[model samples]
Every structure is written in C-alpha cells, then in structure tokens.
Target: MRARLDAESRAAGFVSTGVCRPDAVPDIAAHLSTFVDAGRHGQMAWMAERMAWRGDPAALWPEARSVVMLAHSYAPQHDPLSDLDRREQGAISVYAQGRDYHDVVKKALKRVARWMVAEAGCEVKVFVDTAPVMEKPLAQAAGLGWQGKHTNLLSRKFGNWVFLGAIFTTLELEVDAPEAEHCGSCRKCLDICPTDAFPAPFQLDARRCISYLTIEHRGPVDADLRPALGNRIYGCDDCLAVCPWNKFAVEASDMRYHGPHRAPDLADLAQLDDAGFRARFSGSPIKRIGRDRMVRNVCYAIGNSGAAHLKPVVQDLCEDDDATVADAARWAVERL
Candidate 1:
C-alpha cells in the first residue's frame, strides 16, 4: 500500500512524500507557544487563533492516526537573487512569480487523497497551508526535510522550494524516520538577510522579515526597513535562495509556477489602480495584497531604486485615496 501510495502521489505531481503519526513532533506545542508569546508572528493574529489545533495535529482530528506530508516542487530555473539587481523592476519572490501555489498544491493533494481513499479505504482530509496546520515541523517530523537554521523546510533532494501540504487519515500507516537538522554552522541564509529577521540560528522574527512586511503586514512599514526592501514589491526570498541545499533542487514540471511574474517594471506596477490591480493579478497570488498595499510597496521600491527618472511615475500617486499609498509616494519622492 505504501509503495502504491508513493507511485500514485508521484503520478499526481508530488515530488516527495512521507507518513508519520499525528503526534510525531511532541515539542511543536511548546515551540509554537514560545514564538507567539514573544510576538514574533507580528500582525498575524491567525497564528494565535486556534492555538490547540495549530499546536497539536492529533488534537485537530483525533480519529486521524497518520499524517501524509507531501512536497510539491516549485524550484526556480533562474537564480531569484539576480532579480534584485534589476533596480527599476520589482523583484517578486520566485514562489509568487508563477500561479498561486495554494490552488495548485491543494488540487494535487486532493487527487492524492482521493486515490488513497479508493485504494486503502481510509478516510482523509486535505490541507494546503489552509486551516491552522503548521506544515513545516510536520514535514520534518515525516522525514520530508529538516527545518533549517532559517526556520524553513530544507530538503536534501528538493531543496527549500517545495510547497508543503498535508493529508490526515484514519489508517495506521507506518511512519518514516524523522529527518535531523544538517545546517552545520552554515550562515549563508542568515548573512544574506536584508532585514536581520532571524534572532537566533533556528528562529525568525517575522516583524523584521521582508516577506512578512510586504505581504502580511498592513499600513506603512517601519521607516527604517523601507530602504532594505529594495525593489522586492511582494514576498521576499533571500533566505530560501541562499540555502546551500538548493543545488539539488529539481525544476518544477508545472510551468505555471516558473516565470510568469519574474521582474515586472516598477513604473508599470506603480500605475495600477484598484481595478487594474485586480485584472492584472486576477489568477495570481499577488492579488491578495490588493492595490493599495501593492502600490505602497511599489513606492518603497521606487524610493530604494535610486532611479530618479521614475520619480514622475510615483509623483502621480502622491495623493492616492489610500493614505498609506499617498504617504509611501511622498516618501519615495523625498528619497529620489
């Protein structure tokens, strides 16, 4: 059954798979409590909500005896760091450059789960970073990969770029051996951080993280962090790109996730109104940030660009209806 499960999952586009008991990570509850108590999650109150289910997968669904953790590859063909040097263009994270991974990965997870139901007669539920599931620790516990010093999954075979999804099942599947951390004094992911988001070897302060600042954060970012943002208008990927294990990453078979949004011109992005923003990113994950936040981020990027020629582009937005957008525009003009 396990071998057949692997074959079906691979056929459904999963790059890797592992099974583990729901309580595989006994320390997860404590680890989560510590992070939340410290407020490192910043504005993400959802992380604080449903603490019990987030802390313990077993408690989430007591009938589930095993968790089938899966990894769907989205590795970039080109080095994402190279996009940073395109100062006049916005550097979207490699993950966001393509279609939304949530939609893609969840669809694939459902397919795998459906097959398991038919073949093994097990009841299952699927989650793709949806709900309160903390997938990275569970992935490590299922032998998918270890949570590296950067606090993100780092797979030896697929690197740090795989999207994680979970399958909760009632079957008593044999569990895989948990993977151990292999960071080994490597500081590449740590040293390359533009915002110094990591306070320790295996911890992240999301408040100072650029990805959090650009995406999850609402309103004006700390003035101090704006310059470091450079042209990364959406999510940031510095830590993931710098991981040593990325050398082994295989290219994603799904072309929808590779090169659609690479480095769009900052000037072009700065002109988007609410309707334009919706239309442009209609099917993409970038749409979630909305026009106001996206334009605000673009203003910051333009300010860091030092491309004085683009001043007129943001100058038109100096009195945007959204106060945050207007403030960021004024800030950009001053910087230029």
Candidate 2:
C-alpha cells in the first residue's frame, strides 16, 4: 500500500508522500497554545478559534486511523529576493505568482484520495491549507520533512519551497519514522528576515512576519514595520529564500508561476480599483487579500519606494473610500 501510495502521489505531481497515525504529533496542542497564548499569531484569529480540531487532527475526524502527508514542489528557478531592489515594481511572493496553490494542491489531493478509497475500500478525507489541520507538524511527523528554525517545513529533497497536503483514512498504513532536524548551526533563514519574525529558534511571531502583515493582517500595518515591508505587495519569502537546503531544491518543472521577469510595477498596482484587481488576479492567491488590502500594501511599498514620480499615483488614492487605503496613501505621499 505504501509503495502504491508513493507511485500514485508522484503521478499526481507530488514530489513525496508519507503516512503516520492521526495522533502522531502528541505535542501539537501544546505548541499551538503556546504560540497563541503569547499573542504571536497576530490578527489571525482563526488560529485561536479551532484549538481542539487544529491541535488534534485525530479529533478532526475520530474514525481516521492514518494520515497521509504529501509534498508538492514550487521551488523558484531564480532568486526570490532579487526583486527587492526593483523599487518601482511590486515583489509578489513566488507561491502567489502562478495559479492559486490551494486550487492546484487540493485538486491533486482529491485525485489521489479518490484512488485511495477505491483501492483500499476505506473512507478518506482530504484537506489543504485552509483547513484546521496543522500540516507542517503533520508533515514532519510523517517523515517528509522537519519544521526548521524558521518554523516552516524544510525538506532535504525539496527544500523550503514545497506545499503540504493531507489525507486522513481509515485504512491504517505502516507509518514512516519521523525526520530529524538537519538545520544544524544554520541561522541563514533566521537572520535574513527583514522584520525578525522569529522570536527564537523553531518559533515564529506571525505579528512581525511580512507574509502575515501583507496577507493575513488587516488594516494599516504597524508604523514601524511598514518600512521593512519594502516593495513586497503580497507575501514575503526572505526566510525561505535563504535556507541552505534550498541549494538542493529541484526547481519544479510543473510549478512555473514565477520566472525571470522583472517585478510588477507598484505604481500600476496602486492605481487598481476593485474590478481591475479582481481581473488581474483572477486565478491567483493574491485575489483573496482583496483590492483594498493589496493596494494598502502597495501604498507602503510606494512610500518605501522613494519614487518621486509615483507621488501622484498614490496621491489619487488619498481619498479612497477604504479608510485603510486612504491612510496608507496619505502616508506614502508624505514619505515621498
């Protein structure tokens, strides 16, 4: 069954797969509570909402005996941070540069999950990032990877750029031994963070994370973190980009959302209305942030840009109906 699981997962475009008992990660609840109690999850209230189901995947569906974890690669072919210098262009995270990963990964998961039920005559449930499942911890428990010092999964084979999907099944399979931490003395991922999002090794403060601020964060970002945001309009990948294991990352052939193209123009992005924003990001993960949040992020980038010519672009947004957008626009004009 494990051999067939690997073969099917590969055919479905996943780089790797592993199985573990639903209760493999015993400490997940403890870890989650600590992060939330410290108020480190920031504005992501959902993290605190599903404490029971999220902290215990076994409780999510009591009948499930085993969890199948999969890794899909989206490793970049070029330096993700190279665009930080392109002041005029908005630097989108590589993951959002192509098709929405939730769509792509969930479709593949459903495909393989259907196969699992048919072959094994067992009930199965599937989940992607949007679920309460703690995939990073589950993935590590399944032996696919380890949660690195930066608190993102780091795979020896696929590096830091892989997406995780999970399957819970009644058909118990032989579980693999969990992977051990290989990060060693490497502080590269930790030190590269522009906002020092990691409060300690193997710990992340989402409040200070650029990815959280640009995506999950609501309204205007804290004033101090605004400048460090630079031109990142969607999400930030500085920590992922600096991992030493990435040297071994296979640039995914099937994942080609990002390329050698220069960054998208920030001035152009700041000018987008809701309709234009939706059209531009129709199949993108960026669409979820909505135009107001996206433009608000762009306003911060524009302020950091020091591109005097773009003053008028942001000036037009100073009166945007969205209070956050208007405030950000005013801030950008002042910074200029």
User: Best candidate, TM-score-wise?
Assistant: 1
Task: Summarize candidate 2's per-residue lDDT along 1-336 as a digit string, tens digits.
Answer: 889989999999998899899999999999999999999998888889999999999899999999999998888877989989899899989888888888889999999999998899999999988789999999999999999998999888889899899999999899999999999998998899999988889999999999999999998899999999999988888999999899778667365456322378887788888999999888888889899999999999999998999999999999999999999999999999
* Candidate 1 accuracy as lDDT: 0.92
TM-score of every model?
0.99, 0.97
| lDDT (tens digit, per residue) of candidate 1 on 1-336 | 888888988998989999999998889899999999999999999889888999999998999999999999889888889999999999999889878888899889999999989988999999988788889999999999999989999888989988999999998888999999989989999999999999989999999999999999999999999999999999888999999899999778588997568899999999998899999997799999999999999999999999999999989999999999999999999999
Q: Cα RMSD to native, each candidate?
A: 0.8, 1.4
- Which pairs clash inside model 2? none
TM-score computed on alpha carbons, candidate 1: 0.99
